[model samples]
Structures are given as structure tokens and as C-alpha cells.
Target chain A: MSIPINSSKAIFPGLITREREPVNLEFAFPTLDGRITPAEQFYVRSHFPIPEIKAEEWRLSIEGEVEHPFILTFEELKQMPARTVMATLECAGNGRSKLVPKAKGLLWEQGAVGNAEWTGVPLHLLLEKAGLKAGVIEIILEGQDEGTISEEPKAPGTIVFAHSLPLDKALQEQVLIAFEMNGEPLTAIHGYPVRAIIPGWYGMASVKWLIKITATATRFHSYWQTLEYAYWKDLYGKPTLVPVTEMQVKAEIARPALQEVVAAGSIYRVTGAAWSGEQVVEQVEISTDDGQSWQPATLLEEPVRYAWQLWEFAWNVPPTPGAYQLRARATDAAGHSQPDTHEDMRRTYMVNFVAPVEVIVK
Target chain B: MSIPINSSKAIFPGLITREREPVNLEFAFPTLDGRITPAEQFYVRSHFPIPEIKAEEWRLSIEGEVEHPFILTFEELKQMPARTVMATLECAGNGRSKLVPKAKGLLWEQGAVGNAEWTGVPLHLLLEKAGLKAGVIEIILEGQDEGTISEEPKAPGTIVFAHSLPLDKALQEQVLIAFEMNGEPLTAIHGYPVRAIIPGWYGMASVKWLIKITATATRFHSYWQTLEYAYWKDLYGKPTLVPVTEMQVKAEIARPALQEVVAAGSIYRVTGAAWSGEQVVEQVEISTDDGQSWQPATLLEEPVRYAWQLWEFAWNVPPTPGAYQLRARATDAAGHSQPDTHEDMRRTYMVNFVAPVEVIVK
Candidate 1:
């Protein structure tokens, strides 16, 4: 299926992309200024053309291990007690462009992450209404978007976008069946009728154009869980694949953009944002001399559980003019911090390295 | 005369102000995200309605103590070697709202400052081209904006906006006759065709809607110089006025916004911007224990003279939820730092005290 170029263009004007087969659009750094990005400028990563669904005709079905299987229409979902959350969403393939071994999928930069206000009905409330069973181990979410996975050509076939979440995560109050963004109805390109909003997890977990919810008695296995979004690692000289889940700590400079010229002997402000999926960002440290020395940056405010926190640093320019490498690294409450480089990764999936930006002073 | 509400509204949407007669529009903190603000969104502190001038017909005349008195058309000005500089502009009465005794003029908050990319011909180059004569003491710049200053009801009359610059300042390479903002032609609300850009000084030093520049052999004094922008100080039991020139060291928090709610047990990022007028901001420190303790914040990059440098600190939120006060203080190259309070000032103008922002942890 051909990608809808007109719809993508109208919504994302300056979106950076590497291919059009699956329609992957990366957000630029400038648009990531405020805490919440507008729906039109939000990043889009799809494995297939967006499916057209009429809101009135669409229904979300809850089945499997639930005692009382139920279906909810668009209007019924909105009628439930609405909860709003400011959550930061990041793609599992973020920072893929900086991977040394060359990742096979979309080469995404640091713009794949964005914090947005999502309003919806909590998944736990819906699950409560449906009466959950004791043996439920996982819940599977299925989206209407369907396409063929050609990464393994031998096993290529038509499949819908689906992912499974642990029972505990699915029961969290933060997880929601979102239909609104920034207090307005979601745009057509951003899952018009309904979508799953899984806070503190990779974007793939929050399936768009969601249609079905299934409670399973055992681990839900799928190609998305076992192949596409997993990270390949060397386990005791043998290869192993681990499923990507909560985001790792990472930071990026937004102002004094890459290769920007600054005045010599002048004061310049370095500002950026940092986040960790499940853990709160504890600290953000900046290095001007290539990691030789580091200083703590001011965290703008108390961080939201699933939202990125803004940070800034005051730099007094040196007397002489020259090129300087600036880098920021974030540490989370779990004691995890960004690595200096992810060059050793064989196939990039969770590339959370601290990328350096070069700036010239003259 | 009624204020031009339409023009002010178009230029400054979230401008905080007291009255509209003199049109005192302060720059809001949220808008100070990137290095440069958009032209339309830049703060407007006009004394009169925006003057409509045809760029093609406008001419900048250089007269007085120059060997070659010449007038350059708008096109001619653009043809000169264009230099783009990232500089910050701040009103002299930036923190007037925080003054305890209360200021006489407009009560401005911390949002009266913004950094921008200005492109134009260097003023020193123009001075050199005009062939400066010996013994030049000052240069007078006159704008086409005519207004009446009715601060005192007894004294009210029409006057043109004009200011004089010292010979050394006028000859500095950093000064420019800017015709563009953020790489675009100056907006009608932001001086349009041409305006003077004096770096390292308050915004009043930059005369908008430029018409003529006169080199003088002696100091030139005007109402703006001797009265309006001056600070009243008591010298030996006698009150005297001192002209406000270079900006004092000031620091303000940008994120977490004023009175914002933060999450408990979540690590919060404290971010803010700091600047010095005549000196470079050497360091920025943050205090969360109500002035009981201070910790140094990381300076992101070298400070740009006359521009605000962004600073940040990683603050681990306390486990318990409660109200906390956050304050940031900046130290300049001259060992000068922001004062804790300026309550003793008779009439507030340069209130560069360290403003405390209260945030609730919940």
C-alpha cells in the first residue's frame, strides 16, 4: 500500500524521514521546545498506511479471560470519567541513526520522543467494569493498521499491528484508551477514534487505531514482541534478543542548534530536555570539554512520572574563539545514565547514547 | 491619545502589562524558550502607535561631527556587509512587579527579556564609512516614533523617541543598524525597516524607527537620558538621578512556571536563564532551602556578552509532598551577584533581586 503523502505533508511540514514504505516521520528539535507538542507536529512511525475508520461505526471489544466480555462505542468511551496525563512517548528505535553497526529499520534521530497531554478513560477502570479473571497474565492490544513484515522475507505475510502488555502494566491507572490530545479530539493522522496510551513504555506498546483488547492466560507471543522491537545482544559469546520496554535515560540539546555560531567572549544559554520512561530523571549533567569534566544542570521543575523534564545551563564564553563539543547526559532514579557511545551494538534498537553537538564561537 | 491596541495585540499575545497608554508589553517567560523569539512574538514596549514608513523612501542620514555626512537608503543599508549577532534585549524595569515599595511606572514581571538573532550593518562600519571627525564625544540617534510622556500630569507634551550613545559605544563593532530579526525583515511592530541595536545595554538604548544619527562633540542629554530611565539614589542625604546603562546581573527561572504543581518523589529539573549587561555571567547557583543553602548549577556553554545564558540544576525532590521555594542567583565576571531583595529602593527600575518561585510537590 502506498503511503498517504498529502495527509502526512499537511500535518508534518518539517518532519525528517528515511523512507516512505511504512511512513516514518521524525520530529525536529525546534518543535520540541514546550512541554507538550501539538498533535500535527507529533512524530509518526507506522508499519503501514493509516487505516480509515469511521468513529460512529468503530467499537472496542474486550474479550478473552474477562468474566463479562463487553464492547464500547466511541461515545460510550468518552462518557466514562476522563483522566488527563502528560506523558513522554519514545520509539524503541530512537537514536538509530547514531548506531555504529547500522540498524536495519528506520534511522531515527533524537526527535522520536515527545511529551503530550493525553485525555482518556483509564484502562484499569474499563477492566474493572468488565471483571478481570485471576489467571490473566497479559493483555494484547490490536490496531486496525495492517501490513506485511518483509524483514524476514521467508515468513512475510499480512499482519495487523499488535502488542501485549503485562497484566500489572495493563492494570496501571496511567494506561488509558485515549481519544483526545491536548484537550481536543485526535486528528485523523493521529488515530482519529481511539488509541492505547501506555505510559512509561515504548510507543509500539501504545497501538494506534486500536480495535480489540484481549486478556490472555499466558504470555502473548507475536512477531512484534519476538522480532521487530527486540534488541540483539551477545550473551556469553552467544546471540540473544531482549524485548525493548521502558525507555533508558537520555538527553539532547535543543538550543544553540548543531553547528550554530555563537559570539566570542559572550554568554550563551544551553537548554535541553531529558527523560526516563519508568523512573524519574534524577539529574542531568553537561560537559563542554568532551566529557573531561561535567557539571550538574538545573532541572526546571519536578518531573512527571512519564514526561520529559526541561533543563538549562549558563555558560561563560572563553576569551578566544574555537569549536566546542557540548554533551548532556541524564541519570534516572533507577541509577541508570546514558552511555557515551553505543557503537558496539550489533543491531540498533535502544540507542541511548549521549550524542555530542559541535558549536563554533567567533 | 488612545493606545494602538490592535498593533500591540498582534505583536505581543501574552504580554503582561499595567496600562496601555505608553504600551508597556513585557515578554513572558514561556516564550523565552529558544535562542531567538519569532518577530511577531517579540515583546513590544512602544510609547506611541507603530509608525508606517515606506522602506524604499526611508533614508538613514549620518550628520554632525563627521567629515562625510551621508544618507543611505534602505536598499543601500542592506547591501552592506551583513553581520548577524545573537543578542538579548531586556527592559530597564524588568522586575518592577517584585518591588516592595512599589514602582511608579508599569509593574513588570520577570518576562521583560528576550534573546534574538539580529541581521544588519555594523554601526561601527557605518561610522567609519562616514569618516568620524576628531573629538567626537557622543552620537545621538533619533527615531520617528513621537509620543507624550504624562507620568506627571503637570508635564505633558509631544516628544520624539531619541537617545545618545557614548563615542566608545557607538564605535563598537557589536552595535548595528538592524533591518531583520531571526533572518526575516523586521516586522512593523519591531521597528520595521531599520532600527539601532546596541548590545550590552538595555532596550531603550536601541532606538526604533530610525531617521537620523548625529555625532556630537559634547555629551547630549534628553528626557529619556536625564529623567525617564534614570534611577533615583540618595547621595549624602540628597536625592540624585543616575542614568541606567549596562544591565545588572539577573537570573530567573523559566520552567516549572510560576506556582506550578510538581510531582512528589519525582526528580525535578530546575532550569532558568541568567544574564549580565557589562560583564559575563561567571556562574549560577540554585537554592531550595529558603536561602539556607546554595549549590552551583552547570553552565551549559560559554556566556555570550549582553545575552542571557541558560542554567540548570538537578534537584531530587523530597520524598514527602509539601511547598518548597526555589531561587536562582547569578554571579557576573565582576563578582557581582543578584541581590536577595530590593525593598529599600524608592522607585523601582532595576530590581535584579533573586525572585523566589514557590512550587507545590504533590
Candidate 2:
């Protein structure tokens, strides 16, 4: 049996629908412990099939644009200088299903996000050993997991799996060729044995089950990574689309989901999580009357970077009957604020918008 | 064998760490389908022992300042107006260990967060059934999880595990007495059969494995909920501490952790998450150079209160040979911003200041 998550004390269990939606959500809650969302209580999002990889058979191949093309088994990779980091991983479609006009796909309700510790070797070290070649403008990656969505060769925009990074990024030390997660080897569903840790990029760019690598001056496109998942929209009424990449600033209330009831005169805790693609979250504020006024909530003791941070606030309810609209806002270290909507983006690559929740005061 | 989450293509043998460290990171690569971190790929944080909850024998009792005090089994609770919702839950200490000067306790390196669809009875239904009595200023909850940690209870401050909800919040329709998570019955580690789904509070206030409810005019205190886990600091040179309750705005790069490598001259998808505790996320900005000119990232979809919203940006790398410091920032709907340091919190609820990643270039 899968280990259980401690969620009974969860604050925002059901603010949208009464059933847990298999997607993304804006979570809010009250907290006493300074822990960010406990690992077990964190959200989850799965795409494709949850692959199961064996460590013994897992081998990392560094072949493209390198002086030495070699395949190193998991054991060999582990023997190399192992680097550890604490980071968060999010899905490109984390909150995609919640878009207005409802895009064609699963109507996910916000369960596709999570944070964890990932351990592995930096890709630069491996690349240095391989000896990067000149003119390697693009680095293409291919994974072992393949599938046929239909009987036909699906459009490159539909089924093939691949992605690329610039030679500069490929050589950067931050680009890790990882094999472990959260102080342990990667779990099957996560990229176990060997996977690329490409910080500052969307999940699409980090190819799992890596089996092949090629360096090219031109771009390498894959059905899943490039065309299908790319974000397209009308820019100033002009049809334009771009590939999904960096993250945007956003937040949600996980505790007081819509329609939650609290006894009159009782004090309740409020809390939730926040993050940005490349920025550090500066502050999180709260308001009870639909953004009428705000107060800064307490933040957890996590270092902010390219990952999620947990936050919380305590709301004192007045003994009165009324309707309350709750909202949370975030700002980053560079002075960026979350937007009310994604209307300004030429393409819907990221959706960093302010979300609100309605609660009834009986 | 423990299902390895790091393997990209398969699920098999791996080890599980009992305690997670703050700086220990494992890299994760996305699968063919664009999901880098799936449900199983996420981390788990268990505050107390995993509760041994049996759905068949489980019971949720609503007592306190109510006209009717009764205990309802899981089945009975489900018989009430059932509600379901998708929300994220985060531990307050999600990134506590990341704080500089090294705070005491678990050194989690992210991965203490998750989203889920929860289904269950609303706490309002139970409150309505009980008919809350006047003068009940707070609703205190006690979970079945019990343990005694060997630590000296400091004067005026000690950690405990009890939370209070004000009366107005108790009547909110969103408050739930949950029984299911993500369409499945509650897992044992999660509150099984019956648990409190209080949105907008930290996971601790949700009170997993709930067993009792009491009404009081004064605040209820517990070691886990108060002294031990919450934040502490000096007020004007005087030792002053603040209990962590509310959330703050925060963000981080989810995909490419620090020191990751990427090919040069290729477009990479940069993604991250952001959220606020007071208002909705208004906007997220990205900067390749730390704190340099910022560009807005794409914000995806509507978010519930207290939940982190997903965002992304696309970066077409420039052929360069220098390191790049990836940076991100966020603003809330009501015009709040994240901070640059946890020290800015003044009271030190463990909220770290925002910072940018230093990605070494080739």
C-alpha cells in the first residue's frame, strides 16, 4: 500500500469541487508547525505512464558533441562527485486545465506540483569528461520510454519525446546529470538512475529515461516537448505561440477551500505555498474582504530560489454572519508582483494570476 | 523494494531516507509527457508517526460548544453533504533547514509539498448539526497521533499540537470533514476515514488522525503546534518568538537546480511556482541576470486561495561563455511583494529571504 499523507488536518481539501481533482489547485491553509507542505501532504501530477526504471540497468549516455562518447551505469555515475540540492519540480500544465474556455485536455484541479531533494552528478562534470565539441549549438536528448498514441506516426507535435538545450546551458555547472532524489535514488515515477536536472526550465526540457544525446547547430524538436505542449495564443489579436518554459509567480489557499464551515467565534489557521520560476518570493499578503485590505502572513524557514516556499497566516473571525472572499498575493525579490490574469502574455507560457476564494460566515 | 522515484523509465528497488537534509538535492528529469514531478515523484513529510487509521473502524467526533455532541463513523460522515476539492498542502518547515545559521530540526531540501483532490463531509454540516453554542471563541482539535519527544519545555514557549478555529471560519461552507483524497479513501498516513479539511492553514492545523474537538475561550496549546516548530526571534534585543501560522509570498526554480548544465544556443523551458498568503498572485517576473531587468513570465490559469500557481517562461539562450544568475520575483493581486531575506521577517517565523540562483556558464 502506498504510504498515506497526513491531510485530515488539511485546510483546503474541497474549495472547488467535493472530489479531489487530479490536477493543479490554489491551496491555502493555517499552520502551527513551520514545515512547508509536508512531503506526504504535497500535491501530485502524473503525465504519460508512471515509468518504472531499474537502477542496475540504468545507464547514462553522454554521446552528443563530446570528445568521448561513453555510457556510464548508475553505479559509475554514483562514483563520480555526487552533488545534492533542494529543489521543487512543477508541471507545465499544472494549472492549465483551469484556463477559461477550458483547453482540450484533462480538467486538472491542481495536484501536479511538488518539492523534493534531488541528489546527483552535475552534467558539466560529465560533459567535461566527454569533452564538448565546438559548434554544438543544440543538445538533443532522447529517452527510452516510447509510446504510440495512435496507430500512425503521431505528429512531432503529438507524440515523440525529446528536448534540447543550448551548448552554453549544457556546459553550465547548474545543469546536472542527476541520479538521486531527496537523499535517495530516484523513484521509478520520478526520473531514477539518470535524468537531466535543468534548473530554470520547465519540466519539458528535463528529459527522463535519457538514452541518447546529439549535438547539432539546428534545433531538435520532439512531439511532446516542442509542438504539442508549446503555448500558443493571440498576441494583440495576432495568432502566436511559443514553447512553454520558465515559470511565473503565483499562489493559492489550500486550507479554506470554498464553502468550508467554521463554528462562530472559533479561530482557524490559514496557510498555503508559493513560488516563481527564477525569482525569489519576497512576501505573501492576505485579505479577507476580497482584496480590500491585506496583511503579511508568516513565511516558512525555507531558502527561496527556483522552488516553492510554504506560507501561512492566522485569521481571526468576528462573531458575525457574512460572506468573505479570501485572496493571497506574492512579490519576488526583484520587485515583481503576481498578475491578476495572464491577459498580457503574448503566449500562455506561464499563468501567474491572483486567485480568490469565497467563504461564508454563518 | 521501495519504488525508486529517480529512475526515469522504471520503478523498482531504492532506499528511503528516514530524515531529509536541507541541502541534499537529487535532480529530476521530465518524462516524455512533460511531467517532471508526478504524484509518486514528490516527497513526503510526516510530522508525527504515520497514523494507523482503519477506515472501517474510524470515527470522526464533533464535540465542543455545540448543542449536539456526537461521533460519526466514516460511512456516516460520508452520508452528509459530501464535498470534494483540489488543493495543495505544504508543511511550514518545508524549507526550514534552508535558513542560514542552520536552525534545529529536519533539514528538508524542499519536497515537503503536494496537491490533491479531497472528498468528504463539510465541517459546516457537522457544526450545523451540533449547533455551536455562544461564547465559544475557539475550536480546538486534537488528533489521534500522540508521541513524546525528549526535549526540555522552554519557559513561556514549548511545541505542542493543537489548533483553534474562530467561529466565523467554522461556518464557512468550504471547511470539510474529509474522508477521501484524490478519489481514493484516505490513506493511513493521511487522516483515514475522517479528518479536518481546513483550508488556508498549515498542515499541522488540519489535525490529521483527528480524535477530539473542544470549545474554549482561551487558546489551546501543544508542543508540536506551538513552541517547538513555530518561529522564534529577538524583539528589540529581547528574546521574542512568533508562532508560525500564516503564509507569505514565495517562489523558486523547479526544474534546473543550481549548477545544472544545458547545451548552448538552444531554447530551454524555464518553469517555477509562486504564491501569496494574503491575496492572489498578480505577476511573476524573470531575469537572466540576478536582479537585472525583469520580463514577465506566463501565468497559467485560475488558482484557489493558499495554493501555489504554476508559471513558466521560454529562454532562447545567447551564445555566451559566462555564468548566468537566474532570478524571479512575484507580486500579489493586492500589491504585495516577496522579501529578499528571511531576516526581513523581523520576527523570524522561518521565512527565508528570496535570492537568485547562480548558474555557471561555459
Candidate 3:
């Protein structure tokens, strides 16, 4: 069967569209309810126009900084031992619109994240067969998607989408080279043949439409790595530009969407998802009294690393008829709580702060 | 006789009240006109309750790192060569409400800025009389007002509000130890006894209720200096925390308030003010076509050094009825233009970006 190019449109009815050409979509956070986001309703983030790589024609190449290099066909890659995992993929710029002095990227509003279950061959198994060489610092995963940077900090010409993972992260048994999502073969728009699911990191680490993998002896820095996905960190007491690795501690209220109206004196179930990468979100607190105090929300399930915990807060509305603001704050197991302020510096990535929703009660 | 403490309340009639105890006030931007903001309508920002330092009882101490230390009472400070200059005092955190996630500080709109004719003693003459010692790095300016920081990144008990300026900035002839605002003596709420007017810096640099002036041989690091007013800057390729020095190039549209409605086919005279600290705002541009295209606005007066330039744009609205966003951007002589987007980091202060005002046409 022939693959469809740029077919992500119209299929997902509920996603908020930011860009049409590159197919950037945010999930309808107010509509979807459940721990696992349905495949049809999952968000889509594309660096370039969706490349049509047929399943039969695709081959995964493993080379560079390895003792033995090999290429595996789609069927051969699928023949290897497989594993299934549930992980959340959050774009680094998910809650960017919430930042004051809104940054110059897609005006995303806390919906650019979704959880999914996938079946794939463990990447470490493939890496074991390839036999990583000594002194290897990174494994660069490349995607078939190629495009030129059109915005500020513009790059020269068309370049392929690529990202590198450290040896330890690549060797993690749960990291997958997946071909199926939610019990079905991957849809063309969702990286059909194979995609690397890099758990515990921002979605950018998971290179989609996997085509080639190169184990590098030195740190691999690409346009997306150093320029786009990088953020300022205080490394050694300096505002050092470092590549974004882990997802920040964040909680987003999905139910009772922004600027909604509700009845006074009614129990509004404030529901949302709290997530962190590598770290566990220990508590999700809801603030209905305009942040003077907070009430702990009930987590629907036990904390899972690299996955979002579904949380609900039963907020009994006061009988007073007035406007109300609902704010959710998530604190990770590492004691990192969400601060509702922005640093003076304004880059366009990694916005994990708490954003509030305003509702009028009548 | 006793001096009244924290008496900056209920004096200013039209000021938008954010906090009552500390008396944080924003000017009614849409209501005021003219270059010099009226004495009764000026904006006020206080770290603590307005200290009522009576002119008779107030003492200005000019001590530390100096060949000759001296003290001056309010009358003595006013006797030392007074100069009147028109300058704009803008809170560094102006327009913070426009930030997406809504920061933790008082949600200041564009009204947290005002231009006034400040008459005061040139600080350089005072420093000249004190005879600066060699190796003096910074001049610390202290206010009589003291309070504990009740917010996040909270500090210890009842600290005095103070800030230090680099030696070069302190030596500028226009930096004031003034006892007068406009043609009248300083108002009770606007630093009753004496205040500093740091031209080309945010209002925080202009200490109110001035009580002490200290010269330090090394970097004078204080709570407000390093913690509150500091921002992360890429120093020597590092995101080093640096004190926020100059006001960023910013323009605020006052004529067309946010979310206003107007006639479709009428001429709308969009007016605003543009000011930059130390930097000369060369041009002010307005975008009526949703930021896709920008048109230059007419600067009403010559560009003042440290004062805002009033500007107007005559827009011939289209006959068709629809919604439109109006954005104003300023470019300084240094070629630094206002960026529409924010960087990723979120700190509490210094937001000088272009914010749009939405309007509907019928």
C-alpha cells in the first residue's frame, strides 16, 4: 500500500492547529479523558512535511562508532524480540503561550503532550548486536524528515531531523524502536515504519520516521540540539546553554477549559495530568481560592516514571457568585515545585510552569 | 512630634491599586495625556509601606569608600545645585500581565510607567563634595522603607529597601538626590523627604524616601540587587545572573485600550509612548494587520534621552467588519528591536516586550 504524504489533517478532529504546512497539532485537552490517549486523538508535532516512507522500502541503518554495522529491513526489525511500554511525549514548547511576553514559537497552550502505549523492539538489543565501540559518547538517531529552518536563528539549507542520546539512556531496556502504537501498526502521520521512544526526556529526543543511527565518539550537536531544544542552565554558576534533557515538573488542568462558565455552589471536578521526566510527580495541588491556599488533588494511579499521573480535585464551589481562577501546581519527587514566574531571559522552549484557567460562576 | 509611617494611601485618586499596604500603584494610562504626568496621577511602586520621613527629621548620609564623608538634611540636599529634567520612570516589571502563564508578581499592565519633570540635586556634585576614593566599585542607595519579602524567594525579617549602582552610572550628572518632583516639593507618597532619580534605568534604580548613600570598594551585593532585580545574562557564554541595568526598548499603546470596540470605516488615531533606558528609541512602529506588516508612527516630539516619546498613528480602518490586533514595537538607535516572543526562562522581573491590544470593528 502506498503511504500518504501530509495526511495528518482532518483525521484528528479535535486538535488545535498552530501550523498547517508542518502539521503541528495540539490535542483537545478538554475532550480527551483517560490515562491513555487514543491514537486518533494523539497530538502531532512535525519538523517538516510528513515524509512518505513506505514500509517495504524502509531500512534502519546502524553504523559509526560500532564494531559491527548492519541494516535491518522493516520485517527483519519486527522479527526481533519486542516489548511494550506506556510513556508520555511532551513537546518542549508545550505551555509556551502561558509565558509572559509570549515567545516566538507556536502559541501552544498546554495541549502538546499525550500518553501512548507502543510495541517495538528494544533499542538496546539492536545496540548489543551492533556492538558499541569504546569511547563512544553519543548515539545519533536520524529521521527521514528534512526541512530548512525558516524562523529566526535560521540555518542555511534543508537539513534532516536528528537527535543524539547518551550511551546510558540509549542502553536503557525500556527505550524502544517502535513500529506499532496502541495495538496497531503506526499510522503514516505518527512515524509509520519505526520511531524511537525516548522516555524521560522531552518529545524532541524521540526522533520520528527513523532512518539511520550513528554512534558517535564525541558529543553530537545538531541544529535542533544546540539551537532549538537548548535552554540556559546554571552550570558551574554560569548561564550556560545546555541541551534540554528531562521534562520539567508540570501540571495542566484539562477539564473546565480556559474561560469556561460554571454554576456556583456546584462540585466541579478539576481534572488534569501531572508529569515529569526521570522524576516522579509526587503531588498535584489545586488552588481555587486564588492561590492563597492549596488542596491536594487525588492521583488516579500510582506514580510511574516518565509517565503522567491522572489527577482530579473535587473543588466544592463556594456559594458566592463571582469569578474564580483554578490553578494546579505539581511538585516532583525531587522537591522541585512549579514556580509561576518567568526568568527575564525569553527563549521559546521548555515551559513547564503552572497555567491557570478562569471560570465565571453565576 | 512624630512622623507618620506608611502614609502613601488614598492620596492618588486615579491610580490603579494593586497592593494597598505597600501602595503599589499604576497610572491610569488611557486617561492621562501630555508629556509630564500629573503629580496626583503618577505611578507608585513601593517595596514596603511608604516611610513618612519628615523633611525636618530626614538625614541623607553620604558615607563609605570616600576621601570625605558627609551628611545632608533635606533642606541641605536641596540647596546643593538643583536641576530639573524630564524623565520617565517605568517599573521594570511593566506589562507583566501579558505573560502567558501569569507570573507570581503583581499583574502590572502597561500603566506602570509615567513621565515627569524631576527637579533634584545632581548626585555627581554630592559625590564630588564627598571626594570619591580610589577602587570604589558601586554606590549603594538606601531608602528608609523596610519590610520582609512575603513572596516566593522570600528573604529574612524586615530588610531595608536598597540598591547599588555601578560607579559609572552613579557618576552620571543627571542621577539625582532630589527633593522636588515637577514644580512642587516631593509628595508624601512619592518619597516625602528625598529620592534618587536614576536616569536611563528602571524605577527601582530611582530609590524613594532616600536615606543613605554608600560607596563600596567591591561589588555591593544586596537582596534587591542580586535576588530581586537580577536576571540571567549570557556572560562569557554562561547564563550568569546579572543585575538588570537598562530598560529594554518598549512601546505602549495608550489610545486604543485592550479589548475595545470601534467603528469599521473610521479613522482611529492610535497613540502611545515609547521609552528606553539610555538607549535612544529611533522609531516606533505600529501593526494593524495582525503583526504581518508594520507601519511607522509619527513621533510627536524629538526623542528625549531618558524620557518617553509620545507617538501617534493615523489608521484608515477597512470598511469590512472583523476583529483586529494592534501591536506597537520600538527600535532603539543601537538597532535592538522589541522581540514579540519571550525566551524560555521565567524570572520575576524585567518584561519589556511588545504586547497587542485586541479590538473589534462593527
Task: Give the TM-score (vs. native) of candidate 1.
Answer: 0.47
Give candidate 2's chain B TM-score. Answer: 0.82
Score chain B of candidate 1 by TM-score.
0.90
Residue B218's lDDT in candidate 1: 58
lDDT digits (tens) for residues B185-297 of candidate 3: 98978888788999889888899998889887755545575556656543112233456778888888876666667788988877778988887789999998879999999
Give the winner by DockQ: 3
Clashes of 1: 36
Off by over 4 Å in 1: A1-13, A153-156, A233-239, A343-346, B1-362
Q: Write the per-residue lDDT of candidate 1 for residues B1-362, one digit (tens) a residue.
A: 21121111222246666457556666777445455666655677776778899999999999889999999999899899989877888888888877764556677788778888888999988888888899998888888888665442111245677788998888888899999888888887789899999888988888899988988775554556544665544322212334567888888887566777777777676777888887889999999899889999877657787777876677777878889989999999999998877734223567888888999988
What ranking of all candidate models by TM-score puts the best one first? 3, 1, 2
In every candidate, what fraction of the native interface contacts is reproduced?
0.00, 0.00, 0.00
Candidate 3 docking category?
incorrect
Positional deviation of residue B71's Cα in model 2 after best superposition, in angstroms: 0.7
TM-scores for all candidates: the values are 0.47, 0.45, 0.50
- DockQ of all candidates, in order? 0.00, 0.01, 0.01
Give the per-residue lDDT of model 2 (tens digit) for A1-362.
11122233544343232123322232223321233334333443333454567878766677756788888887888889977655556556655555775544444455445566666778778777877777777777656655444311123122325677777877766667777666666555455556776765666677776656666554443444323455533222222224566666666566666666654565656667777766778789988877779898777646557667777777776588777778888887777887766552312336556767777767
